[model samples]
Target: MSYRELIFTVPAEIAEPLGDALLELGALSVTVEDAAAGGYDENPLYGEPGLSPEVQAWDRSAVTALFNPEIDHSGEANFIPELLASLKESDFHLAQPSEKIVEEQDWVRLTQSQFAPIQIGKRIWVVPSWHEKPTDPNAICLAVDPGLAFGTGSHPTTHLCLLWLEQNGDLENKSLLDYGCGSGILAIAAAKLGCNPVVGTDIDPQAMVAARSNAEINHTLIQFILPNEDAPELAADTKYDIVMANILANPLQVLAPALVNKMRVGGRIVLSGVLARQADEVIATYSQWLKLSVWQESEGWVCLHGELLSAISNEQSNPSHIESIATPQKKRLKLVLLSLFFLVLLVFAEHLSRNSLLPTLATRIDGTSSPIAVSAFSLLQKTDEILCRSLRCINRSVSDFTAWKINSASLAQESSGEPLKIPANQSKLQVEIQNRLAIPVLFPYLELTLTDAEESEIKTIQFSPQEWLPISWQDSHPLFLLRGAPSGESIHSELAFVMPQNTAGYRVRIFYSH
Candidate 1:
């Protein structure tokens, strides 16, 4: 028998979900790896250390999934196409993935061969259950399975943390807390090294389970709990002699106050999973309660060590500063308001994308955008008959709506009717606008949005046909002036306007005004 493997390469944001989607579609197994692994761009993901993941850090990720041909399904020959169709229904737009056939083999043994006894620092060694412990009696083997959680003493981030623990020699009776204790590797090693009352905490429940199991295999008495646990020893009032955290930079800064609060005065703190360049910022973030310095550097990653010599102000350590789902009334109110603001923007974006509305270009502008605003406000106050005569009217039915829509539009520097001057910052907007309906309709308004290099809105302006249409063209087509562009007729016109300062991009949309 043989297994079918399908592989896909996609952006980092889509990798994890794609893997899970494959699993839900009956894949036997799925694996995700950096698409650029071993290259200069490998795993170039970085975020300020914090609780949430920074998926934007990496450019691309590779995902591979295996399927058993014998599993009940449609035709085996058409299995891949059918699976892809199911994936599309689940909102994953993907191309045909690369495929391969794997003959049956001892997968478990093959996987076990990849993980061997890895000795870290002087006294600690990470040994998979399938491998024997090191011969050295001093070697403290942590029975952690590779990939069971996140850490297994192989990655540089994990290795650096282990080495730091080893150098701390004689931790007997000293309390240590392993923040984000994946697989409980650090907590178990600290326990064996004589640390009393070792504790580990992670947000992921699965990590908590894997960590507890690993601690038991190592025969270490480590208290493993989730961040939300009510364990008395990990209450708000509880503090540790030493605090260690190995997470990305973004989360580190975000959790600075909480992590620092976990340490007793004068207690040491160790932070790993930080890039070399982000050291200063991380140090600055924790400077309020402690002084952190680079303890060691390996493979562009650094382990930070610090001593908390002073107490943080009550305001700095307030519950608001810490991450929690239980937010204060005021904060929740602010969150609701923020959500509403974004919702309004989304509704407008759709309307703006499909159609546009504007009053008119100001008759005069001597280096000022005030006239555009003035004209717009004036149009709003105008009588209904006047407004309809100046701009297009909305409120068309379904079939009529589709028939009358903005076609294509473009914005560029003015190139005709004599050279344009730079002092005015002028540009020409060309739109192929028309109404396909059998009856004539009012000319639509043109709304232009100017944005900066970062795509942030700088200014917005709307124009009526009389304000933007060329005087020469209006004279050439007498009927268009009286009856709006006329039915089945296309009006390809250039609208010129003064660009706002720092304008780097823009959007042009034409739509009937309600």
Candidate 2:
């Protein structure tokens, strides 16, 4: 259930305090604009119906603030009741205005437990968390969960193409792409089918994260990119051997030109996400851009496959094709060498003139240069190997260290049907903090707990923090060593054993930094 705005015409003096109290009560965001000062746009995209049949001067003077108490249709009727009580307690006098702004209750559930995995083809499965992984060896596995936006791979359009891929031409050595990739399933499937350098693009960052995580889980080397519809840089100007899009009809129309441009001259394209009724419209949109070939239709979904046709005129008299002539000019090799020598001499003379004959005195910064130089010189090709091994270790340590006070960590564990708990007030300061242990950990089986000085349990530990780091433990357990630079973009974690809670302050762990 979303929130509603409570429009009250109160005196200007009490508006600020009233808004604050309402916020404290549970409003998500509040805005107080001068209604009396007219000419301001009220929601540029959507225009709300007027509050009353006839506008009152009070409605213009009073601040209309929106509150999201997380109420539903059944709960909205109680708003005036609570407002009346709050008014009486605040000792404010008010009257009902001429108009009422009533919004239909729309129940949106952010919790995604009801969504299940989707079966694309006979052997391809897109298993979201709500369903179990398919046991069939032939099933191509895809682990993901959709939030807010679309793409679970169960849609008719996605299934239609998956079926086609399962029955179609060889995917080996083919460069593939998933344009408007919602969850990157198609792109991942291509990589799993032996396509090299599979690429996926979406408009959402959250979707990109989900896609990357899914790719990692599936062990597919697909690169997912979040590209703006208007920007070309985000969608690197490169061609692919095979491209597929499961996006809708309208965007598909606009995407045809861009997508066709991305395909190699004779490369294939698979376009889904169109209704059966809209298939002809989609076909017509792409026909002008590419030479439309065979199409596959299943369960009212259409997947168009085609080779790109040259837009250039195919008629004769255009010289059929243009050719390049590389004619070398005759020259004296000795004369060219002499010219190069003179140029080098001129450059060296200029360099000598730019620098002083004597060495200038300089201040030397400590430590920064060597470490920075070493890190910069390290081969980037091995960064992933380092990250995966180190992150796995950090995750293990965090799991072995503590479990309480961490609410909603990104490290997803298998459903044990038991809530993770940590002892509270345990003198164990470091290991007792739960949230501190969560962001650094990334495995599914590890657990953390808190114990006392005498190894007794106390209150359940609770913890929360905006950021954390995973510091890699060296070969030994007691000593910890840092591998990479302290990165704000990536999280780092460390482990600690704690005593059962007693509200004891925490001491920092000392570690060597590279």
Highest TM-score among the candidates is held by which one? 1
Which residue ranges in model 1 land beyond 4 Å of their true spot? 8-65, 71-97, 313-514
lDDT of each: 0.71, 0.52
Task: Give per-residue CA lDDT, model 2, range 312-336, as digits (tens).
Answer: 2344445533321111122356668
True lDDT of residue 47, candidate 2: 20
Question: Per-residue lDDT tens digits of candidate 1, residues 195-297?
Answer: 8889999988889889988888788898988877689867877888989899778788888888888889878899998889889888998886778899999
Which candidate's lDDT is highest?
Answer: 1
> Global CA lDDT of candidate 2, please?
0.52
Model 1 deviation from the true structure expressed as Cα RMSD, one decimal place: 18.8
